[model samples]
Target: MAATGLTPSKAGPSRPSAPREAAPAPPGGAFARALRRNLTAHAFLIGAVLCFAVFSWYPMVREFFLAFQTTENGEVSWVGLDNLATVFNDPAFWQAWRNTLLFTVLALLLGFAVPFLVAIVINEFHHAQGYLRLLVYLPVMLPPVASVLLFQYLYDPGYGLLNELLRLLHLPEQQWLQDPDLSMLSIVVASTWMNMGGATLIYLAALQGIPGELYEAAELDGAGLLRKIWHVTIPQTRLVLSLMLLMQVIATMQVFVEPFLLTGGAGPEGSTTTVVYLIYQYAFNFNDYGAAAALGLLLLVLLAGFSAAYVRLSRAQDE
Candidate 1:
């Protein structure tokens, strides 16, 4: 070679020209890869999306439309706020609201608290825990209708087992489901018994996830049981508690079966007639689909608010 400045010295092979810049990734190929990934993702989601659209979203949209429209003699027509006006004007409307609110409050008091307490107690136990869990969950597996009917029999003022037990204790037999003041309470008690199992189980799982070191630390600091629970347990389980609170509120707000089957939906002067039951009456009893849909929309709004609160609380918890 001509002894040119090209003495094969130091820098090795010039890095092969940087591998030709990867051929610019063939824009179409990159797009195709992304498209394929997105299609696969969407394919996995399509079933659930369709299910939600068909069952939940579609019904919600239909309910919205029905709220503003009327169908009489198979003729559907837009009636603006007439349906809402009818729902607002009905005397039972406010009563239903009041009853629903009361039920939600009572359900929180009983349904929310009892399960948490039961879960705490069960979590503390060292023996027969599984059996107790099964016992607690048994009522949940029962058919709701059967459970309601059973409670109805137990609530019978004249011949019910509950009254008989009261009589045995030398207490006066009182009307349970028949008394307007007690009817809602009675229904709530029945509902709590039937539904508390699921909440209790959830609480149990949450409790199990709580590190024992927290409790030990509290105990080492001379914190008593109640103090440990307040400072440690409650704080640790706040997210679950808040979530359960919202769920119980939403569920009790829509209560229909317990009151309906126990006290015939109206419940001794509509004492137990919830908004859902009112909607049922409007739809099936009066054959007023528009009014029913309007009332249902109102309930849906309320539930949606609760759901939003739940989602916010959940996000906060995750953070």
Candidate 2:
């Protein structure tokens, strides 16, 4: 062999140097490409952004401006807290708040709790689940006005189905929408019937997602039905429950249509009058937009706080 240090070793003919493959271009290179991508994404979002701006943001901003301004003979002038003062000074303000509070309490007791309970019961059924679900949800599919009008007729004191049933059961006749003491409760029942389906469906979905093993473990520990629900069902579904509670509070606080259509907006002795109905009266009946906006602003603040709490709770659950 020639001197090993001086000669190249030959295993075979040296393979021709392999051509280097070019690296794939960075997905849209960093700067201009990223800008282009952002522009495209924003372009796709533009329609939704514009819709929210026009319908949601603009209305909210306009309401805030309108709340402090007054129009006299078509001339608008800023009046600061005068509009707010007018709302505060209205004789119906406290009564409206009181009635609204009562409606909210009744709605929570009936509307919020009943749906969750119904959902729980439905979750335990082994047969005809679909039929039951349809039965529960069918009312939600009906037009709201039609449902309200139907409930209004059903609540009539004389010659109504409810009274007929009561009579058959030997129960005393109820004035329903006509009775100051019973009107709000009657509206709560109607509103609950019309609205509970959505909440029930949501609760049902949440309940289904809960691990069956949890209930098995509870039962293995000798937990009874109520104890199993308290330990397993409620704990597992607490997040959904809390969210629904906040939503119900916000919704019930702003109730209007039920009372409006069922009881001529105020009911007997204004027992069913709500803050939203008061706003309606100010805006339409009195043509006092400023006062309406101011009252709406107050309601908006309260709802905003509830919404914020809901968001916080949701985020906590996610974390």
**What's the lDDT for all of these models?**
0.89, 0.92
lDDT of 2 by residue, 107-177 (tens): 99999999999999999997877998999999999998999989877987888889999999999999988
Of candidate 2, the 10-residue stretch with the lowest lDDT total is 2-11
Which parts of model 2 are misplaced by more than 4 Å?
A: 1-41, 306-319
Identify the leading candidate in terms of lDDT.
2
Prediction-by-prediction clash tally: 0, 0
Give RMSD to native, each candidate. 6.5, 5.7
TM-score for all predictions? Answer: 0.84, 0.86
User: Residue 110 lDDT in model 2?
Assistant: 96
Q: Ten residues in a row with the worst lDDT in model 1? A: 17-26
Candidate 1 lDDT score at position 278: 91
Tens digits of per-residue lDDT, candidate 1, 51-132, equal 9999999999999999999997899999999999999999999999999999898888899999999999999997888998
Number of colliding residue pairs in model 1: 0
